[model samples]
Target: MQHQPPARDLPASWPPERTAWLNTGAPMPLLGLGTFRLRDREAVRLSLHAALENGYRLVDTAAVYGNEAAIGSALRELLPRCGLSREDIFLTSKLSPRDHGEAPTEAACLRSLQELGCDYLDLYLIHWPGTQGHPQGDKGNKERRQLSWRALERLHESGKLRAIGVSNYTIQHLRELLASCRVPPAVLQVEFHPQLAQSELLDFCRQKGIHLQAYSSLGTGQLVGRPEVVNVAERQGRTPAQVLLRWALRQGVSVIPKSASPARVAENSQLWNWDLTHADMEELSTLDCGKRYCWDPSSVA
Candidate 1:
C-alpha cells in the first residue's frame, strides 16, 4: 500500500468483538476489502463479488485511486446478484487532496457519491492533512484543511455522510481538529502494522473515543515474510497475512487489506472465529520500531 502500504472457508458469522464502534455509535467491520490499486472495472467487480460472497460487508476506496466509478458500476450489478442492498454494505470514500476548500470539498463529496452511486456514504474522510500543490509545512495547508473540515461538518449534519473522519493525521494535526471542529472525528485511519504500531496515537484515539483503522496492515507485503510473523503463523496454522491483520484486530483496531487476487481477498475475509494469544500479541508487538511503510503525515503542518 505505499504510495506508501488471511485464511480460508472460515466462519460466516462475525463475533461480537470483531467490530469496532465509531464515536457516532456506528459499527465498522474490523476487516474489509480495500480497493487502492484495483482500478479496472472488471477487476473491481471481481474483487467486490468475491468479498461480498465471503462475508465482507465493508469496502474502502478513495478518490485519488481513480476507482470510484468502477466500484459504483460493479456494486450496482453485483449487489443484487449477491443478495444485498446498498445499506448492507458499509461504503467508504475519501475527499481528494485537490479538493481542499469549503466549496470544492462539498462538490467533490457529492461527485464521489454520484460516482459511487450512493445516496449517502457510511463513512467519509479528509484524505490528507496537507492541501496538495502546497509546501509540506505551508500555513495555507492548515487553513484549507480547516475549511475542508467545515464543509465535511455541514455534509455530516445534512446526513450525506453517515460518519466523518480524517486519515494520515498525526497527533498534532488531530489536536488542532479536535479543538476547533463542531464534530469530533469518528475515526483516525493511518499506516498501521507490527512495524509501525503508532502506540501514542492509538492511546490518544482511545482516550478521545476515535476508532483507529489500519491501512498498509501488511507493510506492503514486506513484513509478512519476517521471521517473527512467520513463526507465529506456523505455530497457529495460519497465514502470515492473517497474523498481521489479527494483530491489529486483537488490539481493538480495524483493518482494510487490499489484494488483487480474489483468492487472497477471500482469505483476508476469513478473519472471524479465531483468536491470537497473549504471547502472540507480545511477540508481534516486538516488531514495532516506528518504521512506516507508507508516506508519513508528520511532515504535514
Candidate 2:
C-alpha cells in the first residue's frame, strides 16, 4: 500500500491542550478533528493521520458517515507513527436512527466497533431522533430515541463504550432522557455555531452535567463569508472558521470541525492562542438567527 503524504503544513503543536473529562469521567481533547463527510477512504485516512500527527486526541465519526473503515485504517497506521497507543486516543462513533431498535442498535454498534478496528469507543451516541418516515420511528421518534439511549447504556455497562451520548437532540428530548434514563448522556452533540447559538438548550445541558459538543462549529462554510465573523476574524488575526470555533470554546463547549484540506485542518486547531473578550463573545451571541443548516427534527412530529 502506498502511503499518503502528511496533510497539514503546520508545526507539531496544533491544539496545544490537554484532554477534557466528560460527566462520565472519560477524557477527550477539547478540540477534535471531525470526520463527518470525508467519505473517501484514502482522504479520511490521510486527514486522520494529519490530525493525530498534529495533536488531536479525540476523533469523531459515525456509522452513518460511512468512513469508519478509513478512520480505522488511519488509527492503525497513524497511532504507530505518532508513537501513541489506543489508550492515548479518544474515539467516538454514533448509531444511526435506522438502528434504533435494541437488536439492530446492538448490531450496528458492534459493526462500528469492528469497522473502526478499536477495542471500545470512548463515546457512542444516538445519531438523531428518527426521521418522520423512517422505519426506526414508526411509533414515535422520541420514544425510539429513548430506547436507543437505553441500548447505549447497555453497551456502556458491558464496557463496549466508555460513555454514551446523543446528537442533534433538543432540550425536550434531553429532559425526557434525563428524567427516565438509568445513566444520563455524558455529551450532547449538536449543530451549533454563532448563527445557531442554541443558548437555552446549551444552558440546560450545562446545568444537567452534560457536555455540549459543538458540531459544524463553522456553520458548514456559512461563516466563511459572514460579515460579523469576518470582522471578528480580522480583529483577531485569524480565519473566520477559527473565530467561530473560538466562540464555541469560549462558551465552554467542545468542538469538532471537519476539514479535508490540510490548511483548514491545521487552521481549525489553531484557536487556543487568543482569547475572545467578553464583548467579542457578547457580539457574536447576537448573530444567532436560529438558522439550522441541517434538518429540524422537531418538524417531524
Candidate 3:
C-alpha cells in the first residue's frame, strides 16, 4: 500500500483569548469538537476525550448527527479523568426537522437533553430550516421552523437552554424569524469555509447582533490538501486546515472542526497562536469560490 502523507500538526501555543462568551453570558471555548459525521462510537469517544484533555470545553452535536448519547458517554467518562465537570464544559445540541412543531420540538429538545444526560444545554440550535433535508421539498418547512423556534424560545425562558440559535439559516429566514419571534438568536451556525466565505451573511449577523459559528471550517476535508490553501499554510509554516480555520477566526467567528482521530482532533484545537495580518487576511478572503459543500438554506426558504 502507498504510504499516506503526514497529517498537519497544531501550533505549540495559542492565545488565551481563544474563548468567547455566548449571548447568554456563558463562556465557550472558541474552538470546539464537531461531532458531525464522526461515525463510530469508539472514535467519537476517543476524539471527545482527546479534545477535553487538550483544553477544549465546547462540544457541538445535533440530533441529526445521531451521536448525542455517545457524546454524553464521552463527557461523563472523560470529564472526571480531566478533572472537569459538566459545568466546566459548554454543551450544545440541535433540534431535527422530524421534531418540528410545538409538541415535537419540545419533545426533541427533551430527548436531546436526555441523550446528553444534562439538565440544560449551553446552547440549542434549530439544526436546519427543513425537518430533514431541503426545505423546498416540504411546504411546512417555513412554518415548522418558526414553530420550532418558538418552542426553543420557551425552553430558553424556562432555563432549559441558556441560549437558542439556528443553523443553516439564510438572511431571509433570519429576517422572517426576527420579525415574528420574541428573542433574537444569539448565534447562527452555517457551513462556512474559505470555499464559501459567507461574507455577506456574516456581516448581516454581526450588524444584527447575532454571532456566527463556522461549521465545516475546513471545508469538510475539501481544503485539506488543496494547493491554494496548502501554499498559504506552507508560507505561514502552518497546516492548510489551520490556515483555513484561522481565516474564519480572524473574522471573529467561532469554529468546530470534526475529527475522530486523536492526532487530528488535537491538531484542530491549536489555532490561536498566530494572527493573520490584514494583507494575509485580504489574500485569503480572495480565495472564496462561492461554492458551498452543504445545502444552501437560501434556496429553500
RMSD of each: 5.5, 6.9, 7.8
Across 1-301, the per-residue lDDT of candidate 1 in tens digits comes to: 1010011121334444565667776666677889998898888898888898888888999999999999999999998998787767788999988999999999999999999989999899999998889888898888899999999999999999989999999999999998899999988889999999989999998888888899999999999899999999999999999999989888888899998889998888777678899998889988999998888888898
| Colliding residue pairs in candidate 1 | 1-5, 2-5, 4-294, 6-242
* lDDT values for all models: 0.87, 0.80, 0.81
Pick the winner on lDDT between candidates 1 and 2.
1
In model 2, the runs with Cα more than 4 Å from the true position are 1-18, 135-139
TM-score against native, each model = 0.94, 0.91, 0.91
Q: In candidate 2, how many Å is residue 73 off?
A: 1.2
Better of 1 and 3 by lDDT: 1
The most accurate candidate by TM-score is 1
Best by lDDT: 1
As for TM-score, the candidate ahead, 1 or 3, is: 1
Candidate 1 global lDDT: 0.87
